[model samples]
Target chain A: MNLTVERVSAGYGHVRVLDELSWRIPPGVTGLLGPNGAGKTTLLHLLAGITRPWQGAITARDGSASVLSTGKEYSRRVGFLPQHFTFAEEMRVLDTATYAAWVNGVPKRDCPAAAWAALEQVDLHSKSRDRVKSLSGGQRQRLGLATALAHEPDLLILDEPTVGLDPAQRLRLREAITSIGARRTVVISTHLIEDVTYMCDRVGVLAAGKMAFDDTIDELAKLVDEDAGHGFGSAFEQAYAGIVARLGREA
Target chain B: MTDTAREGHSVEQVLPRAPKSTAPRTGFFWPLGVWYFLAAFVVIAGVTLVRTSLELSFAYEEWAHTNGLFQRSALDITGPLAAAFGAYLSGRLTPPSRPYALPRFARSKAEFLAHHLLPAATVVTAGYVLGLVPIVVKTYSTATTGSLAPLGFVIGIVILNTLLVLGWLFGVVAQSAFAAPIAFAAGFAATLCGYGIGAWNSVTPVVGDVSTAGRVETLAFALFRGAFFAIVLVAALATAAGVLRTRGFQRRLPPVRVFAWWILPAVLLAVGMVRPPSPAVREVNPPKICKEAVGMSFCVHQAHERDLDDLVAEVEPIVVLVGQENLPFTRVEDTALHDGANPHLDPTVYYADVSPRYGATGDRDIIANLIAGSETCFVRPGWEQSAPGYNAFMLTLRLSGDRESGADKRFGKLSDKQVHQWLNSHRNQIRGCAITDDLLP
Candidate 1:
């Protein structure tokens, strides 16, 4: 599924967060980068169908129907992983995935198989019978991803999916998400430029609630002054810092 | 990714799906915590049944003649116990971050709230109904006059459900660790106040003192109480849903038109309050059970027929002794056998006190009271010490093998002819409470 946000304005209790922001997200691994309080979480929440935009509209690229009109039909096709989430600690790993699938409108009978398939994707299939409380932090994160994938949603929105992880665990998650991104649209919001350098094909930068840049990672690397730095990491950081500076001046 | 891992993923995706017809059914109370709730139901109901059976055996005097056993067994502590369980379960189930943790899915908010609240209500209500089975069996075994009180059960169930909903709402709103204990205290206090306050007692589910003869609970009054609590239950549900809506778990408030339906129960409650059903027990004439022994007839209320044989056996020897001594009364009847409108006793018929203390000692006490004459006229000063009828009463007790002070020896010293002459002279005084010390042998 392709999502198009048009001139959207939203806020929390009179404090405006997103101001006339518009962006188009296509299928593949797309990375979203922004500084603190740039409405990245708010934008993800809007795309996940959890909160409605105060003004403007979000619709499918085909323009068949708006998300508000489609309601549950649109929600059924999307999966969301919040920045901080927890599960019923006593629930078994497989039961957690199966419950999520059923909640997302999968038929009850298909839930277990779907859950197993999703867990296999995240490499957590061996721990299906273990209680959630017994899982390591990294395993729990993978379990969250399995829950998101269990219903086979067309659009997957992940907010800070790789926040607290060791280097080894991060590499494993990156591989899992990269594999899933091959056939679906995966929007990953994070502050780590290294993740974008490796896993994302396209990158979008948000500054002051507006899209400051949206292009290929190569194009982003090209924006860096080669005379100042040559390596990929320094170049990407320099280019990202320069964009935030220009957008701050504009604001 | 390695070819092996890719191949494994592909295999998992096409793994054999379980048959749809045999799929595990999922709903409000499905594959997750339902077994725990089922276990709770069985334990609670089983314990309540055993407790009620023990109470019936030990305290038969309070519930023998009426449907008091069945009615009180279902209501008394079961309602508050269920309310406390509901409060604790709901409080534990609904944590502070539940709204944020729960996924925004295709199911409606009302359905979601039902998913949380209905399991507790259902389990507790089922346990309560199961607990009433013992009451029914005991009533069937013993009682022969009054039928089981359906209205009492209906009112009890309504009150119980109302308390459960109230407890659930408290747990959801308070979201505190103390919610369960607070709800338990509140439920028990509410019941105490309902019974203690005179005005509320008439409308509360606990109908006190239904053990009167020919008296049974009235239907209209019970319906009034049931409707009142049922309306409270509806209001509590609406309030709980509203709370969830504000928390963003629910997308919409209940429809405005639903409030219009409250008018019916409200009107019924109002009519009941204005012209309350009177005389909570209405009089009904039921059949009597009677037996004959020692040339004397014994009759009892039909409700006590199960105990008639044992009673006749205990009192038959006493009746023989009374006949040998030429006692004035030749017929004995239970005091509960009279018509409700006329309560006068026959002068020649001995009216036995039937409802108290139901074993061997209690039966012997009846004959002792008869020989001692009516105690109502013995309230005069010095009657206890100087009354000659008391000596004769002690003599009868001694003859019956009950040990008393020297009355049996004093009476034994008299010749049979002399004893007969003294008793013949004082027979009227002994029965009429007119004897003096000078009349003693």
Candidate 2:
């Protein structure tokens, strides 16, 4: 299912994070790029149903239900991997996945198979019997992804899922996300522009809690001046810098 | 290189998929901490049993009833230890971000709380229940009258669960590095306070001296106390849920539903405080177990039937001596069968205050105390120096087989026949506490 954020405002205590932020996410890999303290995680939290919007609403594109009104139903269809997460270390990998599926409303009888499918998709099925504590950092990230995927949710929201991974682990994770994006909507919030260029079909740059740039990768590249640089990295960097600079000017 | 090999095989050529097992895949994996708690419970329970056994060795009367053993084993020390472990487990399980994490899941608030809290609660509760096993076995071996006191055990369990719930709430609220220690202290204090209250006997698993005849614990009073603790358990859970729901959010009073949960407990508490139940022990007239020996009949409470043989062996010789001497009393009875409100002053029957702590020698002391006459009389300050009732004292020492190193030398020695003759003449006066220096030989 696609999601639409309409004129939403949210924050922690006295600090306003998102201000009248509006964005549409279609069913494909959509990358959210933002600088530090730019409200990327807060926006993801709102989408994941972990936090409530102070004003406006988040709803399915067909207007069937709003996240605020249909919380359990919405949560059942959406899986969220927080930026920082921990698991019960003593639990087996498959058991952790199965528990996640059961918690997301999967039938108890189907949980094991669903967990296996999710594990196979992430290429972590070989390590399913190992204790969670025995996993390395990248394997744990994949296990988190497997937990999110075990319930076969329609929308998977991952916040900085590849933040601390090595380049090889990042590429493997990006490949997994690319294959999973074929059949589901995946929203990835990250600081890496390469993640968007390599895997995302569409990208949104969040600046000062507002969507400063939202378009296809080609369009974003076009916004970069030809005199600036050569490769995709330079062009994307130039484009992101331009958006932040423009947001600064507006502020 | 063949033509069929060059093309892909048909879809039906693959092996058939295995049938899905359909069995529930959620294998419960208890955290290492739960195992640790279980081990700790075993060690603590063993230590408690050994300590209690040693204490009871000197006071066998205390171990003669199942209810007493249940109280000493289940609540006296294990209850507080269970609460502390419960708090530590909950604190370790729930981090500060749990409240933020739980709301994102599809489970209801109650389901989530149960999933998080039940494991720790179960381990603690199961530990409490298992701790009662050795005590029950020990009591079963010797106790003769009262069976297990169900009402008292139920009250103990309710009180224990209430402590656990309170500890769980403390851990949930104080999700910090020091939460475990603070929760442990708070849990221990809470259970101790429950024990400290005046209604402790009502809540405790002690059915006071059910082995004694004419005594029983009132079920209604015990039920009321159990109900109070059950209400506290519910209220604590509701409070914990409320705290979890509002944590990390803007601070405000709990929602109406949370307050609604407390209404019943509050009403019950007020009613209970206003007019509480009466004393738990009540009077009952159970049939006495009797045995005849040496021409004198001996009777005791049914709970003391196991002690009758030993009692008879120790007192039969004394009874034969008294019979030979033609003493006024012809029968010995257990004091437990006596009605304290209305004294039965039959001169033919002597009442003996017996306990399981009394061995053969201790039983002999009972007869000596009776023959020595009443010591509560208002006598002169120098009565002992004057050797008042010296004949009676010598007769008692002879009956009890006690050494006479401190006997008065001023009074002349008397044989058993002379003492018996003096006792026959002054039996009524001795019973009435009328002994004087003039009564001595």
Candidate 3:
């Protein structure tokens, strides 16, 4: 997926969040690292075509010039896992996945197999029939992941995907993302530097709705090397801190 | 790829897999708990109210004959209440504070409304039908006494259910736990106040008349009430659908667009209130049906055509007694159906305005009034006009007539010819109460 966002600006009422922000997401695992209230979720929402940008456009030039419009056709190509997501508690895990696929324009004849396979990827295959409310916190998160992947979207965006997961659950989710990364673009937005170090090939850091750094993981590591006095905490955190320091000084 | 190639392509390869199970689960996806509750409440409450009303009046025979129960019970709070509850719960299916799921299944505002609104409307309509079960059952078993006004009943039901749907639509628009009660209140208020005001007083919430079974006003009221409700319901639903489709609440539609919807119903109500349709007047020519009976020609309206022969037979004896004395009026006409609207104004013709049970009994006041010319002015029991001399004349006639088992003693004392001569001379006093006369010689 070759997705281009051109100078998109959005806000709620008088409080501006994303202002003339632009980025291009290539086919790989990309991580968007930002602190709370850094407009990471809003960016993901814009990409998922849930909210309209006040200015500028987001477009995907794949086989067709499919613009990110607020409609079913646009939604079908993009799968989004919101920062805070929930489904009907009475809905079974498999049914939840199936519903997601069905809404994404998957035919009924294909929904079962697609839902089942999505569940397998998320390692919730054994509990497909269990009610979503009955699941553990980690399992519920995994169920959301399975639903997002049910339609095999070209661009899969997960906002704070590992916010409430245990280490083991986080590891399981990382494996699923790593496995799916080759065929489509996976965008994960979170505050944790470790998530970027563990899962992503490319990383972008946002500070106050503006991009502080956008490069490969190795290029981000170069920032840590330039700040030699930042004594080896995690190299990733050191790099993140250096970028934040540089942006702060410039502001 | 060929159709078969596409059909056979494994979606499993693209998605994850579930663990082995003996059977794949498949059943209905419709959520039913709140829906069932709403349907049951509407049906039970509506039917119970109708049944209780019929029992209280001992009017089921009449109700069943004219489909009066259905007419009166067609529009009520039950349907609106159920719709509000069901719609409020449906929003819980995908809470609005959170993202809505059905939008994923739809592309536009119209499509979105179709996807979600259809199910809600279906549940409400089903509730309406279930509520009508009692009336429908009663109708099938009971024989119709006169020509049935079924069109009125149908219009009533349609208007009622439309209001219920409007209630549901409002709940959908509100999209909160409190939405149900708020929607119910608004709906109940609109209908209750509509009826409370004189403008729609004749229209029942169930969509027809609440009283009087046999009059043409019942049908006229149904059509008028139905039209008004139908127009209002459309406006409400249109606004509701528009609100639901909007991405956020508190956003206002353009002023001109608001006018687009509000104007139609407002104008319709204005026109209806300004010039309501009068009840259709069906003039039944009484003179055409006049039949000679008991020294006078008696005629009744077409509705009471069947009772004419029996009525003629019932009055012939009284006429014979009257002819034995002297007579003034030669015609005794019944104006029951018209409720005295079309009375023979000729003083020579005696007319009785009283309701009666068919094949049972005629009003005794008519027979006495024929001799006494006393009009039964229906008023509150406390405000009755007392014509003492006329009352005395009726008492004299009844005592001396075959109604009592005594001899005509007043006539016996005075010879029959002499008694007749005295009464004829004193006819002015008896008929007009213009003068006082001695009761006893």
**Best-fitting candidate, measured by lDDT?**
1
Candidate 3 lands at a TM-score of 0.71
| Per-model DockQ against the true two-chain complex | 0.22, 0.24, 0.24
Rate residue A228 of model 2 by lDDT: 68
Cα distance off (Å), candidate 2, residue B365: 3.4
- True-structure lDDT of candidate 1: 0.67
Compared with the true structure, all predictions reach lDDT values of 0.67, 0.66, 0.61
What TM value does the first chain of each candidate achieve? 0.94, 0.94, 0.93
* Pairs of colliding residues, candidate 2: none
Q: On residues B329-423, what C-alpha lDDT tens digit does candidate 3 reach at each position?
A: 66666654344554666767666442323431454445555555444222224312344443444434552442342244443355444545556
Count of backbone collisions within predicted model 3? 8
User: What DockQ does predicted model 3 obtain?
Assistant: 0.24
Sort candidate 2 into its docking category.
Answer: acceptable
Worst 10 residues of 3 chain B by lDDT: B376-385
Candidate 2, residues A155-242: lDDT per residue as tens digits?
8899888989999999889999998898888999988888889989999999998999888988998888777676555678878888
